[model samples]
Target chain A: MDFSSVFLNAALAAVSPANLLFCFLGTIVGIVIGALPGFTSTMGVALFIPFTYSMHPATGLIFLVSIYCSSTYGGSISAILINTPGTPSAVITTIDGYEMTKNGEGGRALAMAVFSSLVGGIVSALALLLIAPPLARLVLLFGPVEIFYLALFGLSVIVGFSKGSLIKGLISGVAGLLLATVGVDGISGVYRYTFDNVSLFEGIPIVPMVIGLFSTCQVFVLGEQKRTTIVHDIATFSDSSVPRMSDIKAHWFNMLRSSVIGTIVGIIPAAGMSIACAIAYNEAKRVSKHPEKFGNGSVEGVIASEAANNGVTGGSLVPLLTLGVPGNTVSAIFLGGLLIHGLRPGLQLFTKYADVSYTLLVGLFIANVMMFVVGLFAAKQVVKVTKASTDLLAPIIMLLCVVGSYAIRNNLFDVGVMLVFGIVGYLMKRWGYSTPSMILGLILGPMAEGEFRRALMLSRGNWSYFCSRPVSIILLVLIVITLVGPALRNRRIMSK
Target chain B: MTKYLDEYLPIAFLYALSAYFWWDVEDFTADSLMYPRALVGVLLVLTTLLLVFTLMKKMRLPQSKDENSPFKFCVVLAASIVYVFAVPFLGFAVSSLLYAPATALLLGYKRKGMVFFVSILTVVLIYIGFRTVLKVPLPTVTLLGMTL
Candidate 1:
């Protein structure tokens, strides 16, 4: 419980030579992945996870965290240069960033993006360091009933926030929960749906599924597009591209405010970076002195979008580390990484694994600083990655997907699973069903089922036991609100 | 009618899947069957809701676009399936070298020389990273006399 000693140990581990090298490598790789069109940050993290299998837990986490931070920042490079968002989080950046590029001020837009991302990432990282440990302590108060309801609450919120039809999202989520029951039952030691396959004994392999859903599915999408290059003529960055001191001073308040907005949004489960940036951009526009100049080459617009998305990097991890609930898709994959190393989330992360947890926290802060340094010096070079042919990139990414899935347990069956899921993911994406909802369901389904059964057993099958605990009641109310609030809002809009 | 088929067909598929799951869990012990049955029930209900909503024309799902090139997507997907199945037989490196450029050409990339170069480079780099550096034991080809 001594904060000083814990932080000191974490500091020592984070700065170790090996961890530092991993952080730098992760930052560089994250930038490349983020700058390339059709390559998302989620896919980047999922693709590189198997590489971290050989590393120490703390070092491996730091590497992945570094990727999570820089990739969010790296998306703006393509947004500024070619008007194509390298990641979904950067979609809003294209509004004003491309305008600046057309006006021969691409360098200025890039500079503002880098600086705003630095501010947002640093702020969120600090928030994660300050908020997670104390919040994790609350896990001690949760019983099986409370945990069960909490898992349900997470799924409800995801369904509410899903992009398309609510019914489709619910179906996708429920189907994922059903799929999670395939392995041997935890309590009864009886197989549910394995059907004599030995690989199904331990449940579906998460890493391969993740790689297939996020990475290989993307390969198919890119192949179908038939685009040779992301952008025919990418604007060149010049020395004068750097923002002036006056511009930074003028936009400092906007950067800080948007960063705070982004961080808060990030803390809310399933409120992803795209939403965060959209909200921040709107807030920035509302507060700007010259509202007429908002969309057409407004530096504040670029700053707001970049800062907020980067801010989401740290904010999204708080719930994952503290409560075993992922805040977004990338953090969901981080949960997979944590579990892969025999580490569980919640109070144990703070008590028994304090050293590794704190190291990861401190390492995130360093990664943000590293991202700023890399974004400044390497932005020009990394922009060229956007020019790489999708034709060539597809096969290469497919190869990585094959290797990543197979390397996890050295099983060829896992590779097959990856292919099957890859096709399934493509079909899901082509349809309106949400992939993230299904993934969240897969991650939380077992916990929900196990905890629900245990709580019922403890209560001797009394359904009223769920209502006995204050935390369980609160979670149930939250779930109802989450499910109903969106529907009510839609009704209001339609009525108008 | 065809416009709504996207929603209706998926619902039909879900109903069938749920029925299978419901029947499959019949042999499970009461304790083991409880959760799966509950989930199957939930799925059936959700699928029915989706079908009703689609029929009512109340759902606002995005219209499906016909712009995507199905031929290109199918070719790439089929090639990938073959590549995965061939890995254990032909070895990872040889299969990749053959698969990458061929797939690229199939996808309409014109520069054959660059495609070959990138493909070879990809195989060598993966070999070094996975096999040599990480010691992942990637599949190796057994020739007539030796394992390469």
Candidate 2:
């Protein structure tokens, strides 16, 4: 493979007029969605996926990549303006960002956030371009037993990192696997749990289920809020919103360090952006000359939070593109998008589908550039989204959810599936069951099952065959570590 | 008792669900049964552990902040259910026209004009985007033998 030529071609295709237009449109939509309270990047990507169905595969992916990058940055707008983190990943930003707004340095805070996000996004984008191809080549060495163990490793990691009880997280994951078994058995060619329903024969649809879980579930949540608008008083942007060169020079090292931390966390499956930002914020405070200013409107605090969260955008895709594993919930949806377009992740993505894969990778860099440009000039306008009445937006979002679900198959049955899952997701969220863990289980269930069965068949039903392979044994060890390491850490914390 | 119900009832239901699936897998061929049976077995064990933890009071109960209105949630949920059922009969456009404002009002939005405007604008944009641009062939109404 001629690497230089491939890069050149991909850069050309990404910059084509149609691709650029999709990129810009995706950025604008991402900004609006991220600026609005309760409209998360996960929901934003899920809701807009149907619109991309008619697009060329490369173009559709480019649009989605653009949204993924910009939306992570967009949350900062509201976090600074309203003291409400528009996305969960922005929660740390609210500490200093809102304080800055109170101190009437909201414009300066916004400027720092935009610059830091741009730096973070570009750094992670570079990491994706450099790291994924080599990783894809390495993953090609995996066989059925190794792949099965890898899937288990991913599930174990998610369960270990789940926010609540380990038992509940495991239950949620197992239940998701059970639900994934509802259709015909792929290997055995026999119906397992269809119960004579034709819709069940194809199994549950991923797109509709995701729309319900992330999008419609949010609608029901928003319905419970009594406030008309998200925040009563909106902070006005001052003339100092433009980025000052002096501040950028001062915070360059902090932005770079936080972005690197975010990228590393993102590459680890299920260690989401919120965790990345929290760690980065702590690190920044520890090393800062003025640690006292951290919770009291420090630009360094705002930069650390914003940069790290945006840095997660590109890092999350590295695993998804190379190993067919989603690093987080939003990337899990991206996996669904790839499957919908008949593109598989892994070696084939680099070999057979190289054009599309490279286009998406290159397009991510362009998207980050566009996000910076948009964040610079239009952030004040985007903050207006916080004032838009949730009362009005809730029903409108519900309408989009219905149409988005139905558009996938043009089947009303899919919409019903979405509604059912919406209700189920709401109840699951209200309780403490891990929704992301369940979602990961749902996505990885079939892969795990198929590989498990295939490995057994190849071994002629000898279960010991899994232990014969080095990679498989390594994966098993990793899974054990993933499960036990967290408990040990907690125990140590308690003893301390 | 109520707090215990919140913790215990869901685990009990999960146990029952797992048991039914475990029993049901007996109807499958050996190959098909192996995977689901293993999964169900795992689920049964996990749910039992959850139940035991709750009984021992070892698990941290999820904190519930009851600040929001349950009445509004019910209204929206009911409205959504009706709207979905109405889509096939009333068509997507007509159903949405009625569903949007009615839902907003039912949820206690005071501004009637903005609700109507938002509702109408949403329907129009969805029509343009889904129908005209994307070619989705959204469900349409039939009036006097012609589909609208």
Q: Kindly report, for each predicted structure in the order presented, the TM-score of its chain A compared with the true chain A.
A: 0.96, 0.95
Relative to the unseen true structure, what is the C-alpha lDDT of residue A90 in candidate 1, on a scale of 0 to 100? 96
**Lowest summed-lDDT stretch of 10 residues in model 1 chain A?**
A235-244
Residue lDDT tens for model 1, A250-319: 9899999999999999999878999899999999999999777777988899999999999999999999
Number of the predicted model whose lDDT against the real structure is largest: 1
Stretches of candidate 1 above 4 Å error? A237-239, B1-5, B60-66, B144-148
Report clash pairs, candidate 1. Answer: none
lDDT of 2 by residue, A199-297 (tens): 879788888888888888888888877776776778875658988999999989999999999999899877899999999999999999999999999
C-alpha DockQ of every model: 0.65, 0.68
TM-score of chain B of each: 0.87, 0.88
Task: Return the TM-score for each candidate structure.
Answer: 0.96, 0.96
Place model 1 in a CAPRI quality band: medium
